[model samples]
Target: MTRNALPTLTLLSLLAILPCSGCQSSKAEIDRRAQHIAMLADDTLDELDAAVATGDVGDAALSHIASAKSNQHQIKDEADKARTALHGVEDATPWWGRTLGNLAIAGVLIALVILLWQTGIGFVIKRLCYAIGLLIPRSTKASAALDAEAIARRRACPEQRESIAARRASDPAYDAEFVRQKKRKQRDEVSRHALPKEHMEIATS
Candidate 1:
């Protein structure tokens, strides 16, 4: 080849390789996201399965199970589409128009994937957890532990109660005694309205 033609050919070859790399990167990203979605689906499915085994699969839980399965299917379909988009033989097209076009297409595909992940995956996972009413038990346990600690601190340092005051400001359960008294008063009022005075005491007891 002529010296001038050698650099031109090299430049064209480099341009052609760009699309292949982009496609590969896009495919890898899709696979990774798909695997994450699949794992989430599996976790939710396992929860449903456990509920079913225990015969506690209520209507709400069943609905959540269906939703989780739908999410799983959608993720798998997206992964399949991504794989199919990169299915054609590499370097089959000419280096000029086709290479540039492929590069643009790869860029667009990757952008779409990112959009789906940011707006779709996180939102779907949040909705799935909410729909299942999956309130993590650990948080409640932790709060209870905190409340007990606060109570102990209050009793141990009644004269030096700065920490207890701080906790009360920060924690909802800090005013546990007041809440309990208020609830007890409300129940007493309800019982007085609903029953005779003699029966009210028995019912409350």
Candidate 2:
């Protein structure tokens, strides 16, 4: 994703990013880093503008150099969003208060993982993944792989896998694209493997 879009994902990635250190860290580091990058970008932009004014840099060079200002803007925006994240969910809170809340959640998850380690995390993770719809693609692919006789009982005929069908059902635009892709795949198979197409079609159909 673009740097301008990074702030929205900051909280989700925060734990893995900065040292958790009891969640004591503030937005200072994020601000400093982004500001440093923005500062350098601004300096480069100023130099490029000077070069253009002196007729040293051409239109192509100026066009590329103009991107530096946009990059600086994105960096500044990302910093602002990160600093605002502290007060995002609730009103401005004390650092210690936020730390305690994060610690509590972390402690609970850790304790449960330790207690359940004997039971093997595989089953629990699998069940949780399915429950959260993470494994829907795998489920849909398995269904599509079934033989024609077994597939006859199914109600919905899927051209693609998983949630894409639900999307195609809702969006006429996407459905059109889906149909195009299916036709293109058939054309490719026929042209690339004409001799084997007759035998291979039934297995994938």
Candidate 3:
């Protein structure tokens, strides 16, 4: 090789290797962070599971669960922000769409199915015709635990409640519907507690 050629080759090789090495480092960092989040989330959730199983599970337990979920969400947000800073938004997984260009080159049926599911078109269709059956609204019941958790969330996050209150105050249609529902619920409760006809007659007489 010529004397000048040696220096040019070394520079080109370094230029090529540097970006790959940097990418590997970034990938390692991302993996490390994901592991940390997983470990912390697992420990916290296990504790909450035990609480739900054996503990009294009052407002405190519900609060803990809500707090844990909120923390988990925050962890995800931070991870995403860090990744965006490192690799940019385009590198992150697309929220509402998935690419199909790869399918043309190395297409796998399973990968295609998974990608389709990530698309917006697949979402409602999946919900409409999932494994069991058509997933209709109001077809399931909420347990006492779920109800307690919801109440605890409302109590813990006053800001969320304030936002909801603001929305209700702003939207006349929503406010009217909310009032109508509350009145209907109150009427149902009163009807359930009403005395029998004979008992009412005797009491009145």
Candidate 4:
């Protein structure tokens, strides 16, 4: 059987045997046995005493004393055996075995803590570094230079000066190009709608 199955079956067997084992002799039966033994011992003792008290200290009295002594010895022997059996059962237990078992458990827990510290701690630290990096400024010299150039152009251009002085301004180069395009379009329209040479000469005469 598999290791796991073996333990499960063993547990089930123990549980199944519990009820049968628990069905021991009743209290009444135990009490009756105890009373019977006590009565027998008392009778034996009384008979021995009476035989000794009477002047009949003969083979009969001797036999009676021997019988009582044998009974007492048997009872004592049986009690000693029972007590020894109980002690054996108690010593057979695996209670002290848990010391080694608990040490093994503690070793496993320590290994897990070390593993988490080695692997998990680095990952957490890396993530925190990335998050903190995002909040840090990353401005470069090239961008600052471009901004300065745009400001200079806006200051130099006359029409762009006013717009640049407004609450917000476009890049000076862009504003300059826009104004040039507007002037070119206006010149083109004026030339297209101008009077012809003949009309201009008659008007002039």
Candidate maximizing TM-score: 2
Cα RMSD for candidates in order:
30.0, 23.8, 32.4, 28.1
Write one digit per residue (lDDT tens) for candidate 2, span 15-125.
533444444434555556756766776676677668778987777777676776677667667766665674544335567666755765665555455545535785577
Off by over 4 Å in 3: 1-27, 89-205
TM-score of each: 0.26, 0.27, 0.25, 0.23
On lDDT, the candidate that comes out on top is 1
CA lDDT of each prediction against the hidden true structure: 0.56, 0.55, 0.52, 0.50
Distance from true location, Cα of 57 in model 1, Å? 3.3
Candidate 1 clashes: the total is 0
Q: Which candidate order results from sorting by TM-score in descending order?
A: 2, 1, 3, 4
Candidate 4 segments exceeding 4 Å error: 1-25, 59-64, 76-205
Residue 164 displacement (Å), model 3: 99
Once superposed on the true structure, which residue ranges of model 1 sit more than 4 Å away at CA?
1-26, 89-205
The local distance difference test score of model 2 is 0.55
Tens digits of per-residue lDDT for model 1, 129-198: 5334333245533544454444443443664355545664664433443234345556766777777877
Residue-pair clash count for candidate 4: 0
Encode model 3's per-residue lDDT on 166-195: one tens digit a residue: 755764434344444445555655666675
Give per-residue lDDT, candidate 4, residue 33. Answer: 62
Question: How well does candidate 1 score on lDDT at residue 171?
Answer: 47
Question: Model 4, 38-126: lDDT tens per residue?
Answer: 56766666776787789768875688687776886576556445544553342222443444445445555554455545558745654
